[model samples]
Target: MPNRTDLEALPDIPMDDDGPVFREPWEAQAFAMTLELHQQGRFSWPEWARYLHQEIDKAKQSGDPDLGDTYYQHWLAALENICVDKKITSGEALAERKEAWDRAARSTPHGEPIELDRAIRRGEFDK
Candidate 1:
């Protein structure tokens, strides 16, 4: 688990006095995923920081505007990049999973949870 100092080292993390503040459930999930991967010794804090910085830099280069709302997007991208680089998962697998989630979200009713398994079972994604 990341300590206070480690979390604080992240750039523009939407934190309050208590800790990191997430405006959406997916953001919290992404944060938790990163922490869990770190705890598993998949990557060091410095490696995570470097990947995150690279993602942010790439987004800025593409004219992201640095509005802070996209911080977690960069964080998620960094996580994916690190996972791919570490051979934990391939880019193609990530893209497929992302497409599956998109299909699930599109098929789900408003205010209902989007579930990939449900979508798959419903033929939204091939098993």
Candidate 2:
């Protein structure tokens, strides 16, 4: 829901004539999710920018090249940080959900939609 002016204000983001440029589908999805959250008043653009900059800085400290390819990974990390900071979700809850999704994706047939199985629904991740 971010307009051109809003997107333009964020210098860290790479954009093209059509819009933001993403190397993968998840990158695009993360970008869209952040923009949608802003639109819904979850956070202001400046606040989002601050969190994103922090994530990028952390990655750089860890020897990331700040290359365009890893841009969205930082974006996703920032989004997660804000979600936790705002009390929308906890880190532990997110980890559990990620484990469930990983299990579902692993068992799903190629090209089929992934869904949680009985074990996942029952919070059974041991297997």
Candidate 3:
């Protein structure tokens, strides 16, 4: 994983005295995933930066407030784009996974773990 100095070098991402701030657990997860992927040589920091900047710009063009809170949302968007660009996964596959997650989330009780159903686990979405 990239060290603190490495992360601090990036001016685009928000980092305070305590390091990066995330509005939700998933936001932190996404941020960590990005770093992990970069460390694995899936993408370079510069490439990730370019994609993140582009995503933020696109969101701004679409009237996103560009508020600090939505930083992770843009980050996730860029991550998804990079994944697709690298041919790691297809857009349709992501959409299907998202839909499956939504279904799982909706079906589970509040505060319960949302588990993918058997169909989703069986790669039914790819069918």
Candidate 4:
């Protein structure tokens, strides 16, 4: 298992590193939302961290140690894994949601929410 420093040192993700040198505003927003939910007891921080470390370890064993380049992807992937582990959603549910979204997007009002990503955010596809 990783120590406190190793886990705490994870880089800012979901940002274009070429210009900004750090996470962009929306990138920060998404990260914050996830962290906020975790802090609110929607999910355990230890569990989330464990999933991330597992994924990171898999990446390391698979021959990539330069995790800085894939931080957000790893984070997102680990989050998905945790959601699935916790039975929050499933692949079949997401496929159905996507179909529902396709139909909804065509006829729904302009202010209506997007479904696919929303489902993920709401843990609807976690199983």
Candidate 5:
């Protein structure tokens, strides 16, 4: 997990919305691992931030500008690189997951997995 202080200090990273941006290339790699670990329910936010700060400081001390600026394009590159390196799941895997979800959804009599469309059609929300 990352520290609160370091996380606040780090620049804003825009992936989907507002979040931490990896400052160093290796930092990005760590971020990717952290994300995977998060998905797997390993490290919490505090621990992740602390880890990120430790990594960024290491990059600064090492004097490697490859991590890039506040945006840290290199960081993003590193994340992608590491994600590929780890290869726990591929895009195809996600597609398969989605396909399975769809099948399960169609099996349900509610119409959709979320039931949003069915609810709307039923006018359950109408007042």
Candidate 6:
């Protein structure tokens, strides 16, 4: 995991004195996942930074405005890309999982947490 100095060196992270600030639950989740992956030695900090920069650049090329709101979207993209590149997970698996989550979210009532296991038990993942 990156130290405070390393994290501070990165550009445009929404942070407070308390550390990284997230506007939504999934943003924090993505941030935590990256930290855990790093701690597991899945990739070095430099490698993660490079992938994140690439994702940001790619988003810009596709006309994504340099708005603050999309920051975590880029972060998530970098995570997925790096995971696939490192063979930690395949693109197909990610896509399937994303679909499963979407189905779970749809089935969940408002204000309720979406659970993938429930979706699976409901045979939502049956192909």
Top candidate on TM-score is 2
| Clash counts for all predictions | 0, 0, 0, 5, 9, 0
TM-score of each: 0.82, 0.87, 0.86, 0.54, 0.32, 0.83
Question: Which parts of model 4 are misplaced by more than 4 Å?
Answer: 1-30, 95-127
**Residue-wise lDDT of candidate 5 within 1-127, one digit each (tens)?**
5445535654444333355544456666756665666567554555544444555556667776633453353344334333444574455544555565575567678753443344433563233
Residue-by-residue lDDT tens digits, candidate 3, 39-103: 88999988888898899899999998887778888989899999999988889889988988998
What tens-digit string does per-residue lDDT give for candidate 4 at 52-112? Answer: 7787778778887754766666676677676667676666665677676787677677897
> Which of candidates 3 and 6 reaches a greater lDDT?
6
Give per-residue lDDT, candidate 1, residue 80.
91
lDDT of 2 by residue, 12-126 (tens): 6888898888788999898888888888898999899889889999999999988777888889999999999988788988898898899889989899988988765776544
RMSD (Å) of each candidate, 1 decimal: 3.0, 3.2, 2.1, 7.2, 13.0, 2.9
Ranking by TM-score: 2, 3, 6, 1, 4, 5
Window of ten residues with lowest summed lDDT in model 1: 118-127
Q: How many backbone overlaps does candidate 4 show?
A: 5
Model 5 residue pairs with clashes: 1-47, 1-48, 2-46, 2-47, 2-48, 2-49, 2-50, 3-49, 3-50
Off by over 4 Å in 3: 9-11, 123-127
lDDT of 6: 0.86
Flag clash pairs in model 3.
none
lDDT of 5: 0.50
Candidate 3, residue 117: Cα displacement in angstroms equals 1.2
Q: TM-score for candidate 4, please give it.
A: 0.54
lDDT of 6 at 112: 91
What tens digits encode model 1's per-residue C-alpha lDDT throughout 1-127? 6778998888777888988988789999999998999999999998899999999999999999988899999999999999999998889878878888898799889999878875465664343
Question: With candidate 6 superimposed using the best TM-score fit, by how many Å does residue 52's alpha carbon deviate from the native?
Answer: 0.3
The whole-model C-alpha lDDT of candidate 4 against the native structure comes to 0.61
Model 6, 116: alpha-carbon shift in Å?
Answer: 2.9
What is the Cα-based TM-score of model 5? 0.32
